[model samples]
Target chain A: MKRIAYPAAIQALIGELKRLPGIGPRSAERIALWMLQSRDARPLEVSRVIREVQESIHACPRCGFFTTDTLCEICADTTRDAAQICVVEQPTDILPLERTGVFLGRYHALGGRISPLDHVGPEELRIDALIERIKAEAPSEIILALGSDVEGEATANYLATLLRELPVTVTRLAQGLPAGGGLEQADELTLSRALAGRTAVKG
Target chain B: MKRIAYPAAIQALIGELKRLPGIGPRSAERIALWMLQSRDARPLEVSRVIREVQESIHACPRCGFFTTDTLCEICADTTRDAAQICVVEQPTDILPLERTGVFLGRYHALGGRISPLDHVGPEELRIDALIERIKAEAPSEIILALGSDVEGEATANYLATLLRELPVTVTRLAQGLPAGGGLEQADELTLSRALAGRTAVKG
Candidate 1:
C-alpha cells in the first residue's frame, strides 16, 4: 500500500515547527496536530504574537537587549548605576541576572562569543558597540558574566585584553560551588575552582 | 530593583507558546526570542501556514481523519479494503499504523476513549459512527487498535458489546511483549499475557 501523508498545510506547519531550537520531527508533528485540533486556536494566537514581536522588537543600539522603542528598558532607566556594566554572551542571559536583584547596573549583550570553529570572531559580535559604550559612559567597573566553557573563556580573555588599556577595572564572575548545591554533586573542575577561589569568612 | 520583563509583544508570544503541549515558561521564552530574532522570518511563515490549515482542514465526514477536501485520502481511496475497518482512538494514531504498511484496511477514529475521571464517556467518542459504518458497509472485521490502558480497554469492551448485534467480527490488537523488548524489561502483566497468548511455531 502507498504511504499515508498529512495534508500539505499540516506538513508545512510541521516543517516550520521543526526549525525551533529543541523541537524534533515527532515533536513538530505532535505540536502541528495540536495546533490543528486544539479548541481555542492557541497556535494561531501564538503565530500572531510572533509576528507582532518580530515587527515591534529590535535590539537596543547600545546594549543589544530586545526593545520596542529607542532603547531597551534597562538602557532607558536613569536610576540604574551608570558606573557599572555587566557583560554577558547573549540577550537572554540578562533576565536571570536581573532576577537575582543583586545587580542594579546596566547590561551589555555580546550577541555571541568568539568561536573560531563556528567562524564567530570579535568582528561578528557586539564587541565594538560595547567598547564604544564603555569609552563614552566611562563605567568604573566592567563585570564579565559569561559561561565557563572554552568559547566563553576565550571571549572573556579577548575582551579583558582589549579593555586592559582602558581606565575601568575589569572583573569576571567568581567560579565556585553553586548555592544549594552539595560538594558531592560538583564536578572535579568546579571543585578545584571553588577551592582556588575560596573567600575568607569574617566573623 | 524592579523585576525586568520582556516587551509586551514578546511576553504575549511567550504566553501563547506556553499553551502548546510540551512548551514551558523558559522554552516559550526561548522560542519567542528566536521568532523575534531569526533572520529568515520562518515563524511568520509558520503563522501563515497555521491560518491556512485552520481555514482549509477539517475532519473527514466519513473517517474523521484531517482532510482539506470532503473526504480524507484514506476514505477517498478506492483500492483500500472497505470490508475490514480498523478502529483507533485518535486521528493521530492512524499515521503510525499506516507507516507500518501492514494493514491495507481503511480506519475509523473514535477521537478519544472512555475516561470517567476526565468526564469523557462513550457518547463523547465516535462509537455511534463506527456502528453506523459497520451497518452500512457490512465489514467482515473491526480491529480495535486502542491503547492498553484501563480507559482503552473499557472502550474496546463497550464497542465489542455494542457491535455484537451487527454481523461483524470484532478483534483487538494482540497484547504481548513489544517487538525488540526483552523478557527482563517486560512487566508482570505483559509477561503473563505473553505466556497466555503464545503462538504455535508452524516451522
Candidate 2:
C-alpha cells in the first residue's frame, strides 16, 4: 500500500522544480512539499506572476530595457536627458546605474555580447537597432556599460564603428570595473569609478 | 523601437523557468529560450514524464521511499527480508543506504525528526505507523539511519523507547558520522562507519 498520498499535479510541479539550477531531486521534493503545504500561499501565484510578466513584458522601444508597456519607463521619461543613453548587455545591468543616481537618461540592451565561438555576431545583438536610434534620436553621447570580457570589448568595438557614422560622442565605462565582471555584480564603488573615468572612444 | 522579437507563448515558458532555485531572471530567460528552441524534442513529453510521475507517484507504504505503485520495489521485493526495516527521517536518506547496499530489506521514511524549534514532533512524522508496522511484521531489528545531529539523536531516542515495548531489537547507526553531519551529505566512508557500527539501544 502506498504511504503518503500525492496527486499527479503536485508531482508534475516537483519534476519541473528539479530542472531548475541548484535544485536536486531531493531539494525539489522539499520545495514541492513546502509549496503544497503552503498551497494557500499558492505557488501557482509565482507561476501566475511569471505569466503576468511574460504577457505584459516588452523591451523599451528606444532602449532595450524590459517594461510592461511599449517603451521602457526610462526611455518614456521626457525629463531625462534626450542626448545621452547608457548601453549595457542586459536589463538587469540597469539596476546599479539606477541606484547610483548618476546617469539621468536612457539605456540600450545589446541582448548579448558578440562571441564568434558562440556564433553570436553584431547582427545578433541590438547594434542595428542602436544605430537606428542614434540616427533618429541624435543623442549627444552613448555611454557603453558593456562587460570587460573579450566578447563585450568586441561588441563595444563593433558598436563604436557602427556609430562613427553618427555625429555623436561614443564612450566606454572607464577601467574601474574588474575585467570580466558583469555589471550586475559590480559594487557601487566600482560602478562609480567606471562611470567617473568613462573615456570617449576615438573614432 | 524594440530590436528583438520572440513569440509570446515562448516568453511564458521563460517566466516559469525563472521561478526555480538558482535560476536568476537572466538565466531564466536563457533557459526559456533554450527550451523553446528545443520544442520539437517533445517538450510536453518531458512534461508528460513529469505529469505521469506526478499523477502516479506514490511513496512506499511500509518505508517512505518514492514509488509508482502500491509498494516501493524494495518494499515489495519478496526476496528481501521483511524481518528488518531501516529507518530514516527523510526520503533522501535512502540514497546513501542504497549506495552501501549493505543491508538487504526495506526502509521506513519517518518524514523527519522531532525538532521542537521547527514545531516538528513525532506526531508530525510517520512514527505511529512505524510502530504499527513493527508490531504487525515483528521485524528482527530496527536500524535507525538518522543523522548524528541533536534532533536526529532525539528522534532515535524517542523511537527506541517506542520500539522497546515490542519483542524486536532496536539499534541506531553509530555516531561515526561527525557531529552535525547529515546522512544526505555524509561521505561513503562516514556512512559506512555508522552503518557498520550500528549498536543496540540499551534503553
Best by TM-score: 1
Q: What is the TM-score of chain A, computed separately for every candidate?
A: 0.94, 0.79
Cα lDDT, model 1, residue A121: 90
Candidate 2, residues B104-177, lDDT tens digits: the string is 76789998899999999989999989989988888899999898878998999999988788898888776577
Model 1: per-residue Cα lDDT over B1-203, one tens digit each? 46788888888888988888888898888888778668786877878887888888899988889999999999999999998999999898999999999999999999999999999998998888888899898899999999998998999999999888989999999999999999999999999989998999999
Q: What root-mean-square deviation over C-alphas does model 1 reach?
A: 3.1
DockQ of each: 0.59, 0.10
For model 1, the stretches where C-alpha displacement exceeds 4 angstroms are: A180-203, B180-203
lDDT of 2: 0.73
Candidate models: Cα lDDT each? 0.90, 0.73
Residue A122 CA error for candidate 1 (Å)?
A: 2.5
Please give me the total number of clashing residue pairs in predicted model 2: 5
Q: On a 0 to 100 scale, what is the lDDT of residue A122 in model 1?
A: 95
Best by lDDT: 1
